[model samples]
Target: MAASVQGGRIGNLPAEANAFVGRRLELAEIAGLLGAERLVTLTGPGGVGKSRLALRAAHAARAGFPGGAWLVELSELRDPDLLTNTVAQATRLTEQTLRPLLQAVCEHLSGAPVLLVLDTCEHVLDECARIAQELLASVPELRILATSRQPLGVPGEHLLTVAPLPLGERDDAVALFTARAAAAVPSFALTDANRAHVAAVCARLDGIPLALELAAVRLRGFSLHRLLEGLDSRFDLLVSPARPRLARHQTLRTAIGWSHELCTPLERLLWARLSVFTGGWDVEAAEFVCHGGPLDAEEILALLASLTEKSIVTRDDEGAAVRYRMLDTVRSFGAEWLTGLGEAEAVRSRHRDYFRWIARQGEAEWLGPGQRMWAERLTAEHANLRLAIEECMTAREPETALELTGTLWFFWFACGFAEEGRTYLERALRRARAGGGPEHTLAVWAHRLVTVVADDLEAAESVSAAYVWLAEERRLPVPALPLTGASLAVRGESARSAVLYGSVRQAPAGDGGAEFFQLLTLAVQAYLLAGQAAFERCAAVAERLRAECAKRGELWMGAWGDFFVSLAGIGLGHPDEAVLPAREALAAKWRVHDRIGAAAVTDLLVVAQASRGEEELAARLLGISRRLWHAAGLPQLGRPDLSVFHREYERRLRAALGDACFTEAVRKGRELGPDAALALALGDTADAPGP
Candidate 1:
């Protein structure tokens, strides 16, 4: 199952939503180059339609390769280390295992006649080149079509440089303008009255497709004659003499600069401030980050509408909300203006503050019915959050950096970014230590969480020691202590975990919902390891926590509460009572992308199934759990309280299924994707039905 979009022919080469205007000769040459060479690199300036041309070429050339043509968008990717994983994901190699992700990708494409179209590789140029070279070397049948600002510089790479649309009597640029104008202004047409004027405008804009479209959108208000006159004046003012050789670049800059000059002061201000966002921002986010000073909160909506009208920002209607974003080139221009005005630091400070609040709110609300919703919103803003973190670090604002990084612990962990989260946390920690200040409670908590998530026992001990002192100094009942106990238990230190839990106490009733759930999780794990008497106590606390969560509408930890109940039922020999709660916990964790938690719950569900004498079903779930654990990047640290029974269940299932069948069943589970695994664990038959 390749990652196909809504409109595609062979594999995920997206069908053009808007009619492609004119790239006839370029397309012909590209097709020839692609056929002649296995790796064809498309090089061009920004806004020159490099990505569009590459995509069209890939789409047209799809039939040549039997395995299909696939496009992996690299514009939104910031981490080079994830290049292989991202490509694999695009190709839908969904198996989760401990193997190197690149090896998995090589295994998928090895000797397969496939065409991989890598778009926007300029940012991760080196990494993309390395990947392309490795992949092509191993898979002789693989062809790579990459678009970048320059060539990939790999061996045997064929370069095709894309230039702007040609002007003159060809009318290609004019045809493009006319088509877009008709969409923008339905009554608009290319007649003898205005055909020359439209051609002149296209000539002024250097026939750049992006520039022409941006200019075309303005037809809603301006007559052709007046638009041409205004472009003449703005181009003279914005054209830099130093870059005369780069005509298309200058034309694009002039076009964007002209758009900026046409904006109202408030619109311009909003544009500059909006540059702070890396991805896109909704009206709500724009209002929060761009308001104050001369721009009032109420005025932001009107100004944003104006910018959208002028094509300074593009509006995206995703799901239920409208998001506004600037193209990369446009955003860069705005950022330069912001820096010129000496408001760069101020604007980024506001950005960091706004997103930090978002992180804290998400942390507080993650345990409720809105858990999945918050996760989705946070995922959408991930780029902005990363930008904010970078701003904090670069500005030498350690306190802010520490707080922001710490606040995002739940988001990073629950969203399966544990390793990346650790990187940011460590950076912030070094900054804090350099500043010679005591670590704040929030920062300490964040570090401790990261340490535990990364399974770094040595770092966990250091972080917990620091947190313990900070919690006492502030007289705050840190929720992270019990997390430390869980980490200890994972390290096979049940006795030490028991001793640690002896000192850890539940937060006061009025403390917070998250803290209470944290306490309950510790109670269940720590006390169960302590023995049967402590296990009963743990059961009572679990019941209380579940009732309170249900009463208060807490969803995330309430599911964990369900997990605890299932655990108690297993320990108490009530397998029937365990099934439903185990399923409930699995569903909740799956919804929030809690891979580690989901894996642990799957293991518990298998125990319950085995207890019901369903040995085959139990064996299948055991396989699914292994897949889940691999996805989590964590080892199977068995539940200390039930390890004996859990092992016995595995042993009995292996004997019943036989070696070959058991291995096949496990492979079947490994093949079950995240969604199907969740469905199966929750008692729904997989899409194909049957194990």
Candidate 2:
């Protein structure tokens, strides 16, 4: 079952960078179709400008859809199974529940009028159809606009066949070519001398937008007459029998082939090597992975520049670095050539090596002054990291997969990708189970420790036995003693605290920053679990860790430290003393983007506030806590015993305030969004005004 949710809102859509030429008629027809039908698919071969036309129409129709129009680009996504997740991510659905994601999506769009543009659905046609069908059936106000090389053929799908640009005397085809040429050569124009030659080039290319654009780029280096002459040779070599297939597909292939024919050997080799990359890449990455054989490391940048100039690869100048990406059509063409050359595996191996190095560097640098920077960097490289895992799996190199997964544990933990991380970890474990040896043992323990934090007790325990046995057999020092201690403490198992964390009070200085902070936080929790007798000692330890975290600028860890210290104060019957620290920790957790942590700590803060007789504020916080818990896909988190105070505190608040008053206060609190709640928790009440 899905929980109640706000109406859907428009997510992100890529900005149009260049002038969109001549789709007025098609755009009007697409807009009309979308208004009259539930599912409108713009079908045509790739490079026939289906994507550009659809995006323009969607952007223009945004105001008509009250909930807003959203675009989900499928070209970079390879796994069809992730179609739902990809869409959910694009829509920014953060509900991490046991309910099916589809159900969550339906619940989100239940009463909203939203237009979803599924771009480049050809590769995942069936999956896209299924999703559109399901969403439309469940959400009466939801509409879908999909673009593909062929029809989705789902019932009630209105197909708008996207044809090539009209090859008339002054149609879109010639206009698009002239515009691109002017950009490439500022002095170039449609003069009487070269107009017929340009028209002939466009005609031979079947009036395909992609082909004409490619031809125009060549004008920067070749005359119009030279381009037309060279195009004939390439088209002759690309000739195929007249079959019932896409003319633009053939035209696009020939254009891509002609571009390849025009490239220098080094540029051609670099293009083929660049195909291994799923997303864009920097010159450093291209140099490292694509350099070898005839392509010298020194020549990569120059060749990359040449390819960018020719428009085979586009460059994204992101302040610090200029990254490059080939169009999906171009990348696919290059990938086919790479495979035919029997160098696909070799290229992929290089990619995996480069990414492995990056993962290790990130893991190493994640603990100090660069913690936040490293987090952002890893998040940006996440797609490429996934590709590395795929490469390892494809090569049947489970050990490499294990190494990469183990190294990325900190990233997953800090960034809240627990679910997706678990998927990769399990896949790696299965492949490594046969003869993984020591690395396998380490991976198992790492996986177990992460599971405990993700609130998966069953999976945690299932691996706990294996991890313990392996540690004993291998005589490997157990590095996650604090995690076990925290689990026991939250479970009210004070008796086991001595065995779990008693000897690890001052974990060796050699421990990485991630391990040290986790150990410190969990140790404090264990101390608190010793009941009132250990309150003073727990508070002291937590305060020390909090001070250490402050010194190091670790906001997230400091939040947990404050949480432990606050609990200690509450355990000592000083609930008022707990309020400040708990509120501080709640604010810090939200700042760190730890939603689950924020939710868990908010309950404690609410209790502390109520105990101090701040009935209204306490009731409001309780409502916010409810929303946080619901957003995290749980009624509660951590050990069930840890919820005792949460239940008791709410009970007390309800008694102090009448039921109706409590309900009204909660309604107000629920209005505090994630950002506003954090602001209120941080004592920034000006922006989070009460309803």
Candidate 2 similarity to native, TM-score: 0.81
Alpha-carbon shift of residue 201 in model 1 (angstroms): 3.6
The per-model lDDT (C-alpha) reads 0.73, 0.73
**Candidate 1 versus the native: TM-score?**
0.79
Model 2 residue 208 CA deviation in Å: 2.1
- Model 1 scores worst on lDDT over the 10 consecutive residues at 1-10
Put down candidate 2 lDDT per residue, 1-691, tens digits, no spaces. Answer: 1111223224355678688999789988987888899999998887888888888998788777765577888887776777776676566454344557678677655555788899999889889889989999999998999999888878999989898888865888888999999999999999777778878888888888888888899988998888888988777765657643336677789899889988987788899999999768888889999988898999998898899899999998863457788888899999998998789989889999999988878666555566666665666666688888778766665788887886777766666555566667888898877844756765675576456542554554555565555556455455454545445555666567565444434333333433453545454453555354677777877876777777566667777778878878877889978878888887666544566777778887786777677788888888788766655556566444555755776678779888898878887676554555666666677743243
TM-score of each prediction: 0.79, 0.81
Q: What are the clashing pairs of model 1? A: none
lDDT by residue for model 1 (244-356), tens? 43377878887887778777888888899888888789888988888878999999888888888777888887445688888888888899999997998887888888888
Give candidate 2's whole-model lDDT.
0.73
Scored by lDDT, model 1 comes in at: 0.73
